[model samples]
Target: MSWRFVSLPPQDGYHMVTSFVSVADYVSRGGRNTLLVFSVKEPFVNVGVHQEVWLEVDLDYTSKAGIPVVRRDLGGGTVVITRGEHDYFVVVNQDEAPSDPKALYAKYLSPVVEVLRDYGLNAQLKDQDIVVNGKKISGNGAMTHGKAVVLAGNILMKLDVDLMSKCIRVPTEKFRDKMAKDMSEWLTSLERELGYVPPREELDKKLKASFERNLGIKFEDSSLTSEEIEEWERLAREKMEEEWIYYKDRRHPELRTERCVKISSSVAICHVDYKARKLLRITAKFLGGKLAEVSISGDFFVMSPKGFIELLEERLTNLSPEDIPKEIDRVFEEKKPTIFGFTADDLKKAFLEIVNKPEVREVI
Candidate 1:
């Protein structure tokens, strides 16, 4: 059956989120499956439904800047969203959607990757986020909305590096600065890739076209049903309550550390910092039993090509346990990057020095 297509009118922070959740509920109650797309009318701090806003958001900064902190019905890290991001949601009957989160992301987001690649960017589905040239272009998450399942994601059009970093609570200003730099390197947008933001009207047309081609489903033009609207209105008010924003993300004070900690029960996030003549900060994510994302940032100087560190970081990924040293050697030999205060061997040691445990407990 063709999906009921609703292009939500871009509005303030709350309704932008409630629209999809309401649609998902409608689907749960035997309404038609939906493909929904919309953007926010203003920038807002979007907290995951499960996140503790106190830990995830800089509430003071947000209040000062007039950016509303919105809690969405999804699972992901906190992010700052502006109209520059285009959001897409697949709201369907639970019976029709994949039960596994990975399956859900792969099925819906892979097609968006194709759409991105068509615009001359080398895009791929790497785990949950979509990336282009090792930089993430999208954030995605899925959750059951009542009896229906809704998979949601955003096409990051232009990331506000400074604001994004500032809005998140970090251990220190240094961490926030590192975060801004890391985001500038690792996260990307259509504006950065294409040299100009594409027209929204054109983007809107192409977005649906890709879904039709990729999923083999027609989208009937539609609007929110009266029932969905009422639900949206109710949710819009409820989500604004303080209780909803900080629903369930409090940890023990002892559990709080300067370094990264747990995202959920299963995931452990670790940030390794080692100080020598020069500082090195490593943000690592592993996939397929290999290094997936390795962002090395600090006051280190490299004398190869202009993009030597970026090249090194890229090559360091997807390496096996033993291949790391070999990979480091290959990069040093091939690129011949000279450091003012560090040697290639030092670089290799620094990487190995921190990654010496089963759980990534500490770094020297």
Candidate 2:
């Protein structure tokens, strides 16, 4: 299908973010698939949908620096968007995009990989990251927006590593130094590798052509619909309020303890401790509200298949909140993996304590 293509001039934080959201809402209401490309002209800190402002960022630093901190309606880690990064949002109908995570990332990120490779960088998609060699060059994030799947990512042309590290809250200046060093090694930009950043006009043209050739679709240059503009205005107004910037902190003041951090409506990182006959600690990474990565530790004994803990962790993957205790009990009954000290009730309570909380506001 022919997609509507709108390449915006470098915009401020407000328009850059809300444009994709408005377009995604447009698609949800039966508008055409869109490929919106733009860059941020002003420096700003974009907090992930689920990131805690106090835990993750240095508000005093950002506020003093005149860099507005805004929470985007998408999953991923906090990102520092400034003058040099170019971003693209693929807002497509759910039916048009692949539902499988791997398939979706490969399909959407391949164009960027191709563009990077053409620019003499060995760019490839390593899981969710667009990497050059082993270092990440682009950080991509995705989530469903109504009837659309919104995949957003950016190419770092000239990253200010020092500024980024300083914007994040750390316990000490010593730790911040360590973080800056690590960030420099972990992330790369065109300027760092190529001795110069590519011209914006050149990169933009190349990206448009690369996307078309890679995705087997043609783009017809278009503008946002009146409905999308109206929605953008409303979203902009809402996003500008302090509540939206610190939404997570405002809603769940208790999670100030950093027990759970939601990346999106369906994805979260959670932790909880349950006391039974022993101190049971559970750290879980949830995907689609199901336990994706589960780590159980602290004073527990397991009767073994040699790898009973591993097997149990694997089994917990993709199990919903209601199924956790039932599965634990089933495992004990059928597999006899006999985890001593903590009963399924302890496990259930721990799971409920973390998952059933006021975290990400339910999208539905």
Candidate 3:
């Protein structure tokens, strides 16, 4: 199907996020047209839908700097965006895209990978992000809102590591310093990697061409429909309210404490204490590239047969780290179990934290 490419003028934080929801709404109601929106917005910080605003952002600094802090309806951590950064939103019917989270990310981001490769970067989709030389160049996520499937993220042109670190409220100055240093080493931008950043118009042309080639679909330039504009305005107003910006879902800290240690090349152990609706603590040992054992303990309420957590833990054993998310999905689907305050994604995220332990890669 042909897609509509909408290049919106630079907007505020509220409009930038609301546009995606509005487009999703438009597509959900028999609108055959898919959409690709490029959001050029002012500097601001946007937290994940599930994250705590107080824990992630410095409200005083943002308020003083006139930088808005908004929450997006997506999972992941906070991100800072500004004029030089390029944020793209791909809106299509859920059926039009792959259903698997990993597959869906690759399907939408393959074109982006191609674009980066053309610029002489050895870019690949690692986990959920596009990375070059083991450093992230693009970050993306996918979500299903009703019938519309949205994959959105930013292509880094340049990043202010110091500013980003300053805006976040970490537990200590030492931790904040470490975070800033890590970000400088772990994040890459077009200008930093290539020594020059292409103009927005040039990047747009290359991106459009890549999408057309990779997806085998053509796009026509278009403006927002009356319906879409109405929806955008309504969503903007609603999302801009203080209630939504300061929203909190977890009854406790999302990730309270996490630690991982490597014993040998083929053996490692990890412990993660996290909270969603309640609280969960995971202790896992990995051996020979598989989960040798796992334990789940917390204050979470599970409405299932006794020992359901044991069943879940047993199922997780002997599985490859990369396959945990799929296994969790299967267990939930087949068991039809109800885990209060936490969804399958939350479980998957917590489990991946163990898989992504630093020691897991040091051996390789």
lDDT of each: 0.73, 0.77, 0.77
Residue lDDT tens for model 2, 1-364: 6989888878878777788889989999998889888888889888766455776689899988998888777655677898878888999998888876668889988988999999999888986679998899998777776788888889999989999998988889999999999999999999988999998778878888898998889989999888888989899888888888876566444334337677687767766767876556667776765666676543443422235555666777788777888888786676764343466678778777867755522311
Q: lDDT tens digits, residues 23-123, model 1?
A: 98888888888988888888898876534566668888899999999987654567888878888888888887676555777888877888898899999
lDDT, model 1, position 217: 88
- Prediction 1 global C-alpha lDDT: 0.73
Q: What stretches of model 3 exceed 4 Å from their correct place?
A: 249-331, 334-364
lDDT of 3 at 250: 31
Off by over 4 Å in 1: 249-364
Instruction: Identify the leading candidate in terms of TM-score.
Output: 2
TM-score of 2: 0.73
TM-score of each: 0.69, 0.73, 0.72
Query: Candidate 2, residue 249: CA error in Å?
Result: 0.8
